[model samples]
Target: MVMGYVSGAVVFLVGLLGGVGLGIACRQYWVEKRNRQTREQAASVIAEARKEAETIKKEAILQAKDTLFQMKAEFERESKESRKEFQNLEKRLLQKEENLDKKSEALDKRETTIGKREKLILQQEKEIGDKEKELDAIMDEQRRRLENLSGISSQEAKEMLIRMVENEARHEAALMVKKIETEARETSDKKAKNIIALAIQRYAGDYVAEKTVSVVNLPNEEMKGRIIGREGRNIRAIEASTGIDLIIDDTPEAVILSGYNPIRREVARVSLERLISDGRIHPARIEEIVEKVNLEVENSIREAGEQAAFDVGVHGIHPEIIKLLGKLKYRTSYAQNVLQHSREVAFLCGIMAAELGLNEKHAKRAGLLHDIGKAIDHEMEGPHAIIGADLAKRYGESHVIVHSIAAHHEDVPAEDILAILVQAADALSGARPGARKELLETYVRRLEDLERIASSFSGINKAYAIQAGRELRIIVESDMVSDSEVVLLSRDIAKKIESELSYPGQIKVTVIRETRAVEYAR
Candidate 1:
């Protein structure tokens, strides 16, 4: 029984193993079949997708070709149009080139014609020159024959004719000069009179004539002795301090202060009077008084300068210049106060400038500064006018003002209207009657000298000094002096007077030549 049971179990185990093998084989077969089917479906889908892709690729290729063809055709059309336009432009350019060539040819022809005309003109000019030479020769020959017939050379005849013409021209020129002078004098006199009168009427300044010396009266004669001090110490101190000389003469309680500088003299006079009144007569006292008086006088001078500028309505003067102007207050020109004279000149300048339609303020400024040099003339060299001009220039005055200052006294030529105005104003101020004074002896001597100079000239029979020695009238012998000789004689006398004498303003020299015809009746 054990054997049979083992056999049956083995068979059963065999069957079970066979069954399990069969099931695994069947499952493997099914899986293979399914895998084949899946592969076939995938293949088909891949083939269809490939065909669709090919179709899309073809369509894209066709569209690209069509676009390329259309673009090429459009480009061809545009190129054809452009080529046609270019051909038209080329034709137009060729026509313009032909026109330019024709114009060039016409210009060449015109240039040739102009060259021929120039040659003809040159030939005509040469012919004209030849004819002119021939004509000149013939005319010269005729002139020579006429000269020989007249018994005079051509040059001599020409000289005679020139002399005649010159004489006639000279006479006419003299008449014209006289006429012009008359008219000018009449107009100038009226204008000048009006202006001067207006100036004088507007200004009423008092004339103060300063003397060279100033007097200081003392309280008693004993004061002189004290002022003299021991060995003249006090007087020396006073003189040294004031730059003046104290004249302690026996003049009865008075001392004379002498100085070339009026300011110094004034200072000395004031200082001495103060010392006398205070009863202090020492060198220290003298110096102290001098310093005090100097300061006072300086203040006075500054006030005067300010007043002068105020009166003239001029401003913007430099302080240093104003100080120098103030010094003019103490200055005197021929006994005429220089400051007063400057004021008069300024007024006159203003009036004249107004009438002439010039800058009145500028004119007045120039006039006021014209004589500024007189303030320090003794300390410097050169004419006052030139010195004043230099001062003005150094102090930054305008060129016009500097020139006017220099020319006012004729030190330099009056080149500007302002200069001329200043000159005229200066003359009006200085040349008025009694405006200035000279010593009687000098005045008489000047008149005598003027007469003597006039008489010294040749052909002058008599000489007379008239118009306060401003004019010299000389009588010439009729036989000795012709009209021209009389003129020359007058000029000679004037030149001699100018060289030998010094006079103010100007001198007029007149020479008279008169012929008398007398027959005795029996």
Candidate 2:
């Protein structure tokens, strides 16, 4: 029974194994069939996609062909238009060339015509030249005949005509010159008088005449002996220290101080007076007093200069210049106080400058410094005007001011209106009556000399000194002195006076020539 059971079990196991294997085979077959179907479907889809790709490529190629054909046609059309434009440009160039050829031909013809005309003009010029030569010869013949008939050569006739014309012209020019000179003189005289009168009227300055000597009154005659000191040492010391001469003359209680230098004379005078008052007279005391008085006088001079400048409203003067200007206070020119005269000149210059519309301050400055040289004129050898100008220039004065100072006395040429104004003011200041004093005999002698010098001229009939000898009027015989000769005569007389006499300022020389015709009416 065990064996049969084991056999049946084995059979059952075998059947079970077979059944499992068959099911596995059936499943693998089904999977393979499904894979085959899937592959077939995939292959069919790929083939259909390939056919669509081929159809799209053919359509693209046909579109490319059509685009290329259109581009070619457009290129051909542009080429045709370019060719047509080229043909038109060629035709225009040909037409321009033909026109240029025609114009060149015309220019050639015009050149030929111009050449013919130039030849004709040259022939005409030659003919005119020959005709002119013939006319010149004819003119020469006629001139020779005329000259012979006139008994004078052509040159002589021309000279005579020229002389006649020149004489007439000279006479006319003389008349015109005289008329213009008369009118100018009238106008200038009136204007000058007005200006001078206004200047004199505007400023009136006090006149002080200065002298080279100063007289100091002493207490008694005994003071003179004491001043003279032992062995005359005191007076000698005073002279040595002060550069002045002390004259203790036999005058009553008066000591006369004498020096060419007014400033030194002043210092000496003051020092001696101080010594007399102090009653101490010796060389040492005399020197001390002189030194002190010199300082005082110098201070006074500076003050005077400053005062003059202040009065004139001028400032910025150098200290040394101011001191020199102060020295003028004691200086005298022809007995007129130089400082006073300078002040008067300053005022007059200022007034006249204002009237003439010039620089008033500059005028006043020039006037104030016009006589600065007078301070040191005794030491320096030159005209005071030139010395003053040099001082002003050295002290940094303006060129105009320097020139004005120099030309104030005509030492230099007056180059500007300010120079002329300074001259006029200086003249007015010194030339005024009583401004300067001279001996009466000297005055009469100067006038007589002026008249005599003027009368010495040949044509002068009479010579009269007028304006206090400032002017010499000479009457000339009309027959002897012509209108032109009077001018020469006046100049000669002026020159003679200048050489013969020494006078202050300038003297006017006037020559008068008059013609008189007497006719009786019955």
Instruction: Give the top-scoring candidate (TM-score).
Output: 1
lDDT of 1 at 383: 69
Candidate 2, residue 172: the lDDT equals 70
Tens-place lDDT per residue, model 1, 283-385, is: 9888888899999999998888988999999999987788888999887666678899999999999999999999999999999999987777667767678
Alpha-carbon runs more than 4 Å astray in model 2: 1-210, 439-522
TM of each candidate vs. truth = 0.47, 0.46
**Candidate 1 Cα lDDT to native:** 0.85
- Find the 10 residues in a row with the least total lDDT in model 2: 201-210
How does each model score on lDDT? 0.85, 0.85
Error of 2 at 262 (Å): 1.1
List CA RMSD, all candidates: 23.0, 24.3
Clash statistics: count for each candidate: 0, 0
